[model samples]
Target: MPEYGPQPVERQLPTEEARDLLDLVREMARREVRPTVDADEEAGRFPRDTFRQLSASGLLGLPYPSEYGGGDQPYEVYLQVLEELAHASLTVGLGTSVHTLSCHALAEFGSKEQRSARLPDMLGGGTLGAYCLSEPTSGSDAASLRTKARRDGDEWVIEGTKAWITHGGIADFYTVLARTGEAGPRGITAFLVPGDAPGLTFAAPERKMGMRGSPTAQVHFDGVRLPEHNRVGEEGQGFAIALSALASGRLGIAACAVGLAQAALDEALRYLHQRRQFGRPLADFQGLHFMVADMATQIEAGRSLLLTAARLRDSGRPFARQAAMAKLHCTDAAMRVTTDAVQLLGGYGYTTDFPLERHMREAKVLQIVEGTNQIQRLVIARDLLGPEEG
Candidate 1:
């Protein structure tokens, strides 16, 4: 562990307000998140209080409109805020991203009435959210989900299971994607299901290598009913809405990856400067110096890619390809940098004595989530080369 803790990141913010936001976030991270991270992560304790605090501070809905309790901040600023949160504790960071993703379909496509009635509570009323898309048999092939939602008069009866739900049982609301019509992607539609909805249940959280404090569980909807107004977007628009949310969601993952990698790099540098070997500090070694340089370079490159994609999104431009690229590059770089940090620390890094091992484990999930790196490559190639001819 670094004696001074992780250093503050130097940011190129868009405005004075944004800068103040970052400063406030750093203070929260330092005061609320970093101190208890090790203990909570070790115990697999979810930081529900921290999330409530984030909601109270207006941090939960930074990128959404202020009209609905959001901060009205741009994506660029929001992603940076995610990075800082991740740097302090990945559970907080990734949880914030997932919560934001859960709000997307409603915020973007729901009717004005829906927005007026639901958005305020979802955005900042201390309610946590989960996005339900992938099912037991559907991961990367999300369009092939088997979840069914049949209409009965004005209500939709949802019967299906959602796998890998981040907030699962604990979420106050869930933005769920379920089949409502024919089959495949077009048949799918989104719904905002209340957490206390009858017939809704959650499996126990999955045991994972890292980010254990953030629960990941299977959400089961056994004929849960929702009113007609609960549907988000059109009856056959769920897949489109999911894809749109994921495009921006990928950038959130990228920012979190960069933040995790930066944390690793900070730890490694701290170790290098303090740990002495053969009558000299580890920092004096040329080999370790190059490693640090490479780690810093990768972090910078990842930050630039994600920020570029975020700015493009903020400007109302097409950024799906850039988001994929950023997700792929940044997660891969986090994997590399975190592993390198472990190597720099030798046996200490591999053990729970240092955070590097946790960083390494956490970085692996980033590469796989929000679409795997393989999926990202396919997405980027599709953007450039179009669909496969066969």
Candidate 2:
């Protein structure tokens, strides 16, 4: 398949800096990332080197504080950049999102001492991160995570497993949520665990259908020990911290889904223009043309919603509900647009000779990742009404 970016997005960036950032991102995506997709994804090879290059180029920490190696861009610009990257390769874009999510607790809630000591490396010192909140028994019920961390003098001994961790084995550090006091949300605490901790281990990466270039594995804490200083925020605050981080992470997923959908739409349009059907170009068919138009329209709509959510976040306003809605809408649009692209391309879309099938497969995971679409609706409904009743 010919791998190239979709048509450029007409972004409403706040500054010339943001526009330049997007330009650089598009260039990199076209030259560096697009060429590697087929081989790396097919071989299930994690693009560690590509990530290292992104880090060196300062693309990995756009939304954090510049004092600590970040680009210090607003969430609005950061998310747009994410869309560009994801349009090139979902593995790269989604991996960057997960990495940024892993940094949130410390960046937003850590002590000054912790920020001074850790944020620089976590943000841009070529370090990768993973967030550990969901256990095998608890996915959406993240507060019920079974991981336990017990105080032992100046250290904490942690045990239990975290499932579906992106960058699990290869990450440089992990932001972990564990039961520190009681049986529920209020008892959890967050900690920063080094990847090379004495007892930290990982199961084999999951055999996934798409985005296989990004490793998703089960991370086990087998009596892993962390310093007392590694704790993030106050005790009993991990659940809130996790939720806050996810609010932003949801937007990242939304942008990526929009990009994935756009890529599929772009390719489908190209094929329609070039390929003939019934002795006429597929683009000449009103039916296929309508499908293309709808796909493009939905992708644009999703992009607007996602950017609105990002702007709300940048304004320091309460945006959880908008974020959830964006995630739900964009991911669903991606699934629909990609499926439609497959239909638009007919037989070729079903084969590896084209990227529509891969986009379709990858789009499905966006609905499940960050938060499942079902959970997203619950979140939106709760915002519209009130908390779910027992």
Candidate 3:
């Protein structure tokens, strides 16, 4: 937004390779993502081609192991990559995150044979994925999900629906969480269902407020059959696997939030500088200057929290609390910053003439997805004051 190139995001990358990776990502964002994001999003066009390009460029599998087509990059580096992508186009950024989340069950808990057979295609074959955990009856209370999976001979017959599925109708694969045993979280089990599996159907994508470039829909499994080998983990381990995946998933949302906020801040600053008022630059107004400072400060703070949690995760430590906190703080900050950006632009912000309005809408969803801000606060509170007891 400033005349002097882009505002540099200060990062403590672990290696030269990581720095090079960021440079490459910036180039991709500038060339492939940013230029057409607004138009494509407006048209509700899924940027499948852009995702393919990212897969080809090795951007889709950054944090996973290279043995299975991943880049073997650290979580810190991977989160920064997400931030860069979100700064350009949130659809691409959040899509990449969902892809990563969908791969976790197979890559982390699947048998050696399963990973050997499935992880490669998922990580690098340009096949989009969706994680199916939320259902019509379940959102934050995923344990209460009613999706059912019954063992019928050599196959598991899955039935019920998954709501708020990213890439739902169009995903090549879905990591579905269904009830296989008792009730509650332990009864849940994860299944890898092929998109073309018989009895699998998708509702039309939701007409959402923002990030429309990514499809979100209701996925219905009507006795869809999959071989027993498709089960990702133990019969009663689905909820655990889901939680583990979410701990990491929350970090992705946090990074995307920071990126969105940064983009909003960038737009606001540029518009202020160019849109003059009362014979002076809008940016020169002391009140607006304070607002910009606050926005920038919030962005940096959120980034720091996310990276710290990422580093903890990369180092094999428990970073769930940090991830929750970061998700809570960053998404809230994005909502505030983007709304402020709209305010700074005055009436122009409300119009389609500027991207600020779209960004403001996009920022609202971040506060709800991955884990709602209320859920995040619950998590942080649980960390501070143990889980509630009966």
Candidate 4:
């Protein structure tokens, strides 16, 4: 019998270099991530070595400036890379997205001196980073975050807890948002806090339904201090910085969703052809293959939506609306496809012996993270209607 697995996605690339890069990423995913994802996820083991390998391969900073040790690829190419990684394993894919998000504030808003001093190591020197924006009390309402940074001569004292932080306890650095001026968005400021800072601490990772290998925990800054030079952009500018990062990050989530949906679809197709019912293969049934067709169509649609948004971002066009749409559609599609995949696989799908159940559980989080689907709808509405009238 022939083997059944995820085949390569046919992609249209802007250059031969981009095509080669995708090939490298696909090979890495097949060799390094797919084989052990099940065991590692079951064990709740974070793939630190895999991440180091990604960093060494220059994948950690694909969308940033080449002068700073980034790959300098456009978001178009970068997001496709994320999609392929996600097709292999969501933990790896989503982890990479969070790491890229963590670097956004500094890469886009930091001083040239700061970028020169820190970007090389962060981009490719095996360093991992976490983004800190949501507090224990504020998640979607990010502007209301309560973490504070008070100035004390040359150093700033930070005190508060950031909840739902990816790589919370294990990252090498943190891109933190803190209240530095008044209340609300205007008061917020961004800082680069070394993960080993004296007063920084983390709660145990959250036990979740899926993506177990990616740590999500609360990070506490108990009088953590940092020099004035660590500030990114300007004081009272963190909210804008965070929002900007999220627009791009939503595209990352969208790509991940498409990848995951594709994975589930691939598995469903493989099983259908191999499993027989009513004296014939399940795939021979018109109704069943029609379901598979819907799944593939959704995945393709999601992929196109994300790539369109990515190209918009790369071209300096406004993409927040499109990003929100992509995130909403792709994640919702993943949920539907994965659930249908389970139905197709029947009893076997519900068991740990198959990956369908895991895919279903993992798909649920994409709807919740990067702003909940409800939040995405609100964002889309706001863009369509202009800000809510007072």
Select the stronger candidate by lDDT from 2 and 3.
Answer: 3
Which ranges of candidate 1 are over 4 A from the true structure?
A: 1-7
The whole-model C-alpha lDDT of candidate 3 against the native structure comes to: 0.93
Which stretches of candidate 3 lie above 4 Å from their native place? Answer: 1-6
Top-down lDDT ranking: 1, 4, 3, 2
TM-score of each: 0.98, 0.97, 0.98, 0.98
* Residues 1-390 of candidate 2: C-alpha lDDT, one tens digit per residue: 753334556888999988888999999999999999988999999888888889988988899999878898999999999998999999999999999999999999999899999998888889999999888999988888889999998899999999999998999999999999988899999999999999999999999989999999999999999888999999999999999999999999999998888889888878887898789878788877688888888999899998899889999999999999999999999999999999988999999999889999999999999989999999999999998689
Per the 3 Å backbone cut-off, how many clashing residue pairs does candidate 1 have?
0
Candidate 4 local lDDT, residue 297: 86
Q: Which stretches of model 4 miss by more than 4 angstroms?
A: 1-7
Model 2, TM vs. native: 0.97
Residue 289 deviation, candidate 1, in Å?
Answer: 0.6
What value does the lDDT take at residue 255 in candidate 2?
92
Model 1 local distance difference test score: 0.94
Q: Which stretches of candidate 2 lie over 4 Å from their true place?
A: 1-6
* Candidate 2, residue 24: lDDT: 91
lDDT tens readout by residue for model 1, 1-390 = 545434666897999999999999999999999999999999999999999999999999999999999999999999999999999999999999999999999999999999999999998999999999888999999999999999999899999899999998999999999988887888999999999999999999999999999999999999999999999999899999999999999999999999999999999988888899999999889998899899999999999999999999999999999999999999999999999999999999999999999999999999988898999999999999999997
